[model samples]
Target chain A: METQDLTIDDCWNRIGIWSRGTEKCPSLADVIHCRNCPVFAETGRRLLRTPPHEGYRREWTRILADEKETKPLNLTSVFVFRTGSEWLGLPAAMIREIVPMGPIHSLPNISSDSLRGLVNIHGRLHICVSIGSVLGIAKRTRNGEERDPAYSAPARLVVAVQENRPVAFPVTETRGIVHFTPEMVKELPVTVSGTKAAYTTGILQLGNLDIGLLKDKPLFKALTKDLK
Target chain B: MLLLLFEIGSDRYALDARQIVEVVPLVRLKLIPNTPDHIAGLMNYRGAAIPVIDLCRLLTAVPCENSFSTRIIIVKHQVENSGEVSLALMANNVTETVQTSLEALPPSGTIMAETLYGGVSGPDASELIQWFDVKKIIPEKDFLFPAGE
Candidate 1:
C-alpha cells in the first residue's frame, strides 16, 4: 500500500490490535489475530518504510520555517541561573565557565558585601562575589542557620567578566545555556523590583516566570563595586 | 469620534481612538531611574524603545497594578516643542471602545483646562466618563528624559 494511503489513525489501530490480540481485532476474524493478519503487519511495515511522503516532509519544513521567521533573528545564547530566588539570564559569551563552588578563601579587611574573596581554580585565583548581596536579594537561611557554600547542594560558581576583568559569583542553581531569539525579549519595566531594575537589560518570558537578562556591565559593576 | 474607555480604580476614562495606535497587554517596562514617578520607563514597541507612563499614577495617584485587564494603550502624544511621538499609557481594567462625538460629550465644568479634557456619558448610562487630556500628562522636559538630562 502507498504511504500516502496510510493515515495516523490506521497506524494506531494496527498498534492497538497487536497489543490486544485476536479478541480485540476489529476488521480481522477473531481466530486470525494480528500475528497472522497480513494487513496489520504490512501496515506496520509500510509505516516504518524509509523515504517518507514528500508532502509530509514539505509541510513540516514549511511549519518550521514559519516558526523560525516569526521568532525574529539575532540568536543569542544565554546561561540561565537562579540566585536568591530570582532567575537571571547571562549571555554565554561573557561567561567563562560554570564550576563547582570550591573553597573560597575570605580576604581580610574587605568591606564590600558582594566581594567575598578568592578561589583557586586550576592554579589561578579568581575573585568570588556573592550574587545575592550584589543584586540585593536576601539570602535564604533556615532558622538563621547559614548553609556552608562548600557543602551546599545548589551552590555553583559563575565565572563572568567585569570591566575586562574576570569575576566569579555564586549561584543557587545553574539551568545551563538556552538559545533565545529576539522575540522572547520583553522590555524590563521600570516598575520592576528596585534590586534588579538597574542591570536587567530586558525580561525573557520563560514559562510562567520572567528571567531578567543581565548584561556584562551591570553584573560586573555590582560584583566589583566597593572592592576598588 | 470613537473613544477607547478604560478604568483606573473607580473612575472611567477615555482617549480619542484616532490617536490610539494599538492596545497591548501590560508587559514589563524597563525602568528609567531619576525620572518622575509618572514616567513608567521604556517599553519595546515593535523594534524601537518608547516611553511608557502610568496613567493611573499621573491622573489619580493610583499605581497601575498588573492584572488580567491591565493594558498599555499606545497613542501619539504631541509634545510642546517636539513633534508627535508615540507613547504607551499604562492603565488598568480597560473596558471597551465606544463611538461618541466631542459635541456629544458634555462639558466637565471643571475650570482646570490643562488636565480635564471633557466628560462623556458612558455606554452604560449610569457611568460618567472623564476624557483624559494626553497633552497635560507630562511636561516637555519631564516627558521622556529626566528634568535636566
Candidate 2:
C-alpha cells in the first residue's frame, strides 16, 4: 500500500500497557508484549515517513561550519566503570574481555571474602573475585532498585589478564573507554590509604569528576594476591 | 576545516563536511531508467525522493562497492530555477573525519585544467589527499527533469 493510504492503529494504547482502565487486547494473551504485535511494528515504520524537522539542515551546517579541534595523541585508554557509589577505571590494555554476567560458583575451604568463586568461561575455569573489597569500594546498593531499562546499562563481568593468568570481576555497569594523555593525570592526595590508594597511581581528569587511573601492575598483582 | 574522508579506487578524497546535512548508511534505492551511469537512483528519504550520485562511478567509472563503510551523504544542492533540493552522494569507506587547518594546506599545484580538486596535502608525507569540490559535481548542466527551468 502507498504511504499516504497507511493509517495508524492506536490499539496498543487502547489495550496495551497504557490501557489501565480500558479493555485488554485478547491478542495480549498470546502475543504477551505490544512490541511483538504487527500493529506496533507498522506504526514504527511511519516515523521514517515524517519529513525532516525544520532547522535540521541549518543546525548541521552550523555544527560543521567551524574547523574541528585537533585531539591530542591518546597516550593511554582506560575502561572506566562504576561499583556502588564509586567510579573506577582500569587500563584498556589490561582488560582481556567484558563478558556478560554469568553464574559464579562458590568454592570450598576458601575463607577469603575477596575470592568470589570459580566461573567457567568458554571451557576455561577462571577464579572470580570481588574486586570492590580489594579496592575498598562498598557493595553496590542500587542493583536491586528498578531502573528505566531504556537508560540503564547492564552489569558485566570484566576479565582482566595478568601475565598469562586471567581474573574475572563483576562490575555494576561499564562506561566504555576514556582516553587521556600522560600530562592529564593529576597527583593523588597523600592522605589516601589502603589498596585503593596503592592501586590508584594518579587521578585522570574526566570533565569535572576525577577518575582514579589504576596502576595495572599493582591492581592485577592485588587481584591474584590472596590466592598466591 | 573538517572533512569527510572516503576512498574512490586507489585514491582517497576529502569533502568539506560543512555542506553536509546528514550521513546515512547505504540503503536500497529505486533505479531510474534512461539515466546516466553516475546517477545511483532515487532514495525514499524521510518521505521525500532524493537523488543519489555514486562517487566511484562518477569519478572512476566503477560503482561503489556495497560494504559496511559505504554511506550516502545528504546535502542541499542549489538546482538552477528549482532552488535548493536535497541530494544524496553514495561513496565507499566514508568511515572517518579529518581536521585540517585552512592555511596550513598548500594547493596541489596540479597542472590539469578545470579539475574538481581544490587543495592537496600529504598526511604522512606519503599519501596525498585531494579535496573534492561539491559544486563541480552538481554543476548547472540541467541534471534534473528541467521542468521548472
Candidate 3:
C-alpha cells in the first residue's frame, strides 16, 4: 500500500510545541491525532523496509580496521639545549641527570678553553666542559649580544658517560625532551662550521629551530683526551 | 648512452651514467690525517667506509663550494686484478642525465692531461660538456684500493 502524503503543517502540528505560535493547530485539537497518525507510522514502516546502504557499510568497516591497525610513529626522545646561540639535541639516554649549576674551579696552566674544570655535585666531582667553546660557537645573550664567556651563568650541567668516565657539559639553557622520527634527521652538511660539524651526526628541522644532533662518542673523545 | 652531467666550478663535465652507482646528499666527512688535499675524507655509505675525492680540488686548484645541488656521486672503479672499489666523487651542482653519442664528440684544443677524453657542443643549443674519464680520476696505477678492509 502507498504511504500517506505527509504535509509540512501536519508534521509540524504533531509536535505540540511547534503549533503554539501558529494561528491554527491542525492536528493538535484531537487527543488521539498523533497516536493514530497514518503519516508518522507509515514513515517508520517505510524506513524499516529499505535495505542498508552497501557503500556506508564498506566505509565503516574500512575505517574501523584502519583505526585498529594504525600505530603511532616511532620517535626518538632527544634533550635539547642552547649553547653559543645554537640549539643542539642530545639523545636522552646519554644524559645521567640534569643537575643544578655548580662552581667549576678552573685548573691552572691548562690551555684548552673548552675545559671549564671540575665541579662538586653532591660530594662527587665531575669534570665540566664548555660545549660552546669546544664547538667554537660564540656565546651570545638572548638578545644576541656578545656575552663574556667567563662571566656567563652556568645554568645546568648535563652529566654524560664518556669512555666509562662521567663528563658534565655546562649549558646555558635546557629545553626538556622533544621527540622526532628518524626521517626528520638529515646528515650534517659538509659546509657547517668545522668544529660544530665534527660532533654533529645530522640535523633535524624543528619549527624555527635547527637542532644539530650530537654524536656522544666523538664529542667525548675530543673533550676528554689524555693531556700530553 | 646516458651521461651524468655535472658542474665543477664553472666548467661542465659528463661521466658515463652506467659507472655511477648512486647519488647521495653531501654529508660531513671524517678527515683522514696525512692524506692528500684532494682526498676529502672517509664517508660511511651503507655501513661501508668509502674514500671521497673532491673533484674540483683534484681537477682544478679551486675547492668545491658546497651548494644545495652538491651531491656525492658513488662510482665503481675497477682496479688491476684487485676487483672493483666504490668511491664517492664530490660533484658540485649535479644537474641531470642526457643521451649523447661518443662519436658525436669532436676533438677540442683543450690540452688538459688524461682527464678529458673528448669535448662536445650540445646536439641542440645546449652548453658545451666535456667527457670526464673516471679511470684518469682514480688510475689503477696510482690509486691503492683498500680492498674492503
Candidate 4:
C-alpha cells in the first residue's frame, strides 16, 4: 500500500491487528510500515500503542480520557464556607487553616477601608480580613435587624495560603468541604459584574446549588505585600 | 481610549484610562501607621492591599472630605523594572469616560507643568486635564521611609 494513502485511523487498525498475532508484537516496520511512513518521525512521542482486542482498545480510550479529565481536579480541592446568603468553596490547596476571630488590634490614622488588623492565632499574629469589607458588601451592623435565629451564627476565620504565605479570611460562617469534579465547574460570564469575580476561579455547580470557588493565591500574595 | 474621568475637589483630572481597573465606592479601609498624610491608608481590594491616596491631599494639599460622591478609582501602574504597582485614588466623584485621540488634544499652552504641577490638556481645548504623577506624589523614598519622616 502507498504510504501516502495511510491515515491515522489506518495506522491504528494495523497496530491493533499486529498486536493480536502475539509474535512479541510486530516490529514498527511490519505494523506501521516505518520505512516509508511520513508519521514515523512523530511515532516515538506517544508512549502507548493500540491494543489488539476490541475490549482493550475501548478500555484504553476510557483510561486516557479519564486521565485528561482528572488532572485539574488533582490540583484543586473544594473548601466550603459561608459568606452571606449561601455557602462557597475555596480551593483546599489554598487554605492554610481555620482560626477564631479574637482581639484584633486596629491601626489608627489610616484609610477606614483598610482592614489590616491583627488577630492572634496560636501565638502568631495573622492579618484578619473583613470579608464584607473586602467584597464592598455592607458589613452586618450590630443595630440592624437581629440575626435570624436559623441563619445567625458566630463569625469564623478561614486562613488560606495566598502567595505562599498565610492570610486569614473572616467569614460570617463556616460550611464544611465539598469536592468538585471537572464537570461541576464553569467559568463566570463577563456580564456578571463585581470585584468578587477577580479572585473567583469559577462557579461550581452542585446539583441545584451554585458555589463560587475562589482563586485566593494572588489575593493572599497581594495582601501579604500590603501588610509588609 | 477608555478614560476614567474623576473630580478631585471641584477640579476634574484624569489618569491613564488603561491603568484604571474599576471605580468602587468608599469601603472600610484599614490605616497604615507612619505613612504620609496624603496616603489615606489602604483598602482590601479583592484580596490585595490597595494603597489609597487622597487625591485632594496629594494634588492640592486639601484633606479628603468624604461625601456621597466620594469614590476610589483603583489604578494599576506598572513600574519599569519592578512589577505592577496598584494604588487607589480618592475621587470626589466619578465622571463620564470620554474616548479621545492624542491628535485631538488641545494646544500645550492650555496646560503647563512645573516641577510639581504636572498638567495635560484634554481633547477638548477648553478643558484642562492634570496628570496625577502618582510616583512623584508618593515617592519611592516615602514607602521605605520610617514613620515620622
Model 4 clash pairs are A96-A160, A110-B31, A112-B28, A112-B29, A113-B28, A113-B29, A113-B30, A114-B29, A114-B30, A115-B30
Docking band of candidate 1? incorrect
Q: lDDT by residue for model 4 over B42-142, one digit each (tens)?
A: 66666656567787887678866544346678776665555666667786656456565543233233123222213334334566656445555556643
lDDT of 1 by residue, A82-193 (tens): 8767788888888888888888899998777878899987789988888777677655465656744522455788888755788888888888898888888999776786
> Residue A167's C-alpha lDDT in candidate 3?
82
Best by DockQ: 2
lDDT of 4: 0.60
lDDT for each residue of candidate 3 in B1-149, tens digit (9 for 90 to 100): 78888878788888888889877656667788887788888777666767888898887868776543566798887777777878889877675677765544344444433335344443334456677776655545334645742
Summarize candidate 3's per-residue lDDT along A55-132 as a digit string, tens digits. 643453344223234355688989999875778988887788889887888888887776877998889988888777
How does candidate 1 score on lDDT? 0.70
lDDT, model 2, position B98: 74
lDDT of each: 0.70, 0.72, 0.71, 0.60
Runs of candidate 1 exceeding 4 Å displacement: A1-71, A140-143, A146-154, B1-149
**Candidate 1 C-alpha lDDT tens digits along B62-87:** 78865536677888866656667787
lDDT of 2: 0.72
Q: After superposition, how far is residue B142 of candidate 3 from its true place, in Å?
A: 70
Candidate 2 per-residue lDDT over residues A1-228, each given as its tens digit:
243545666888888866875689988887799988766765664543343333553353344334444678657899998765567788888788988878889988887768989888888899998777778776434573554342234378889887878999888878889888989898889889877788898898788767888888877777777888
State the RMSD for candidate 1.
25.1
